[model samples]
Target: MSAAHNASYLSRIKPGWKFGSLLVLSIGLYLISSWQVLLVAFILSVALLASARVDLKQLRAPLISIVIILGVVFILLGIQTNWLNAVSSVLRLLTMCLLAYSVSLSTRFSEMLELFQQVASPIRVVGGNPDQVALALSMTIRFIPELKKVYNEVREAQHARGLANNPLAVTVPLVIRSLKIADETAEALDARGFDSAPANH
Candidate 1:
């Protein structure tokens, strides 16, 4: 998100509280089967987003992705069951995604790392390394936007070459770019001695 977005009300809220609320609400979304409830949740999310004052232009990519994903889900569910089931499922999933996107956009990268470490603390007893866990989680969260950029770049290139409708043209390059990112990430971790265990001396 742009620096201007940081001034938004939702962005100014404490990251922990925002994340916790999103987590709980996401879980609740899955438990409720009523389309009315899902529709209400979806509307609330949209209102919260507007209150955040985020630029609608910034949302274009994610909104497109959401439509594509939910369109597939709606089609599959319609084929498997009924239109009512499809609509409810798609709305519930979309609501959860919007809530997640809002939180991610609002929260800073450092706040996300701290939140992950806080969450991982309880798991330390079971051999978890909070620092590493936090780094991994933060990186994964940060990579989402980067991935979107890479995908758009690839799509534009393919479009220029008159392959805009070819799924393989997009998927192949996206996968390759993602793998390259993973490899670079591993190399950076290695350079930081991530693989070294604490000395017992």
Candidate 2:
């Protein structure tokens, strides 16, 4: 329950799932609607996200957008008494968010690239470079953690400057930092010869 202990616990997720256990657990929880199970999943997801163990930056934008959009829709589009659906939908989304976190935390980028290469082999045989695909995969895997770190640093700096509550202070810097990361990543890939295509002749 202590902050430090919680942080350490979050960082200690097992490197991979065994026997698709997370999936089975999720399914059982969904069917049972057990509050303890859902609560644990929510806590675990938050811990993983905050710890940057699962790398949720890639999901932040979409998740936020979905929440905002759905919040408005629920207020205006729904029958206003459809509370059950709203609760169910929100819980389902929270579970999905945790599921996504689990995937990134448990599955290594190398394993993902290997899977991609297997699927893209025919295309690679024609002209594509699996290496480039792998580079993209690496970036995708790294993108979340890197951006989340940047967001925290930027937010802290803003707070230090006494602009912590200013929306622009957070959003602008976050976007700028994300763009800068994307640019640098692209440059690194190019410098590493990842931009080169396979032989055309």
Q: What Cα-based lDDT does every candidate model obtain?
A: 0.82, 0.63
Model 2 spans > 4 angstroms off:
1-113, 123-129
By lDDT, who's the top model here? 1
Tens-place lDDT digits, model 1, residues 151-199? 9999999999998789998899999999999999889989987864434
- For every model shown, what is its TM-score relative to the native structure? 0.63, 0.40
Cα error, residue 16 of model 1, in Å, equals 1.4
Cα deviation at 56, candidate 1, in Å, is: 3.8
> Top model by TM-score, which number?
1
- lDDT (tens digit, per residue) of candidate 2 on 17-83: 4225556766765674545556666676666556654444556676788788667766653466575
**Candidate 2 residue 72 C-alpha distance from true site, Å:** 22
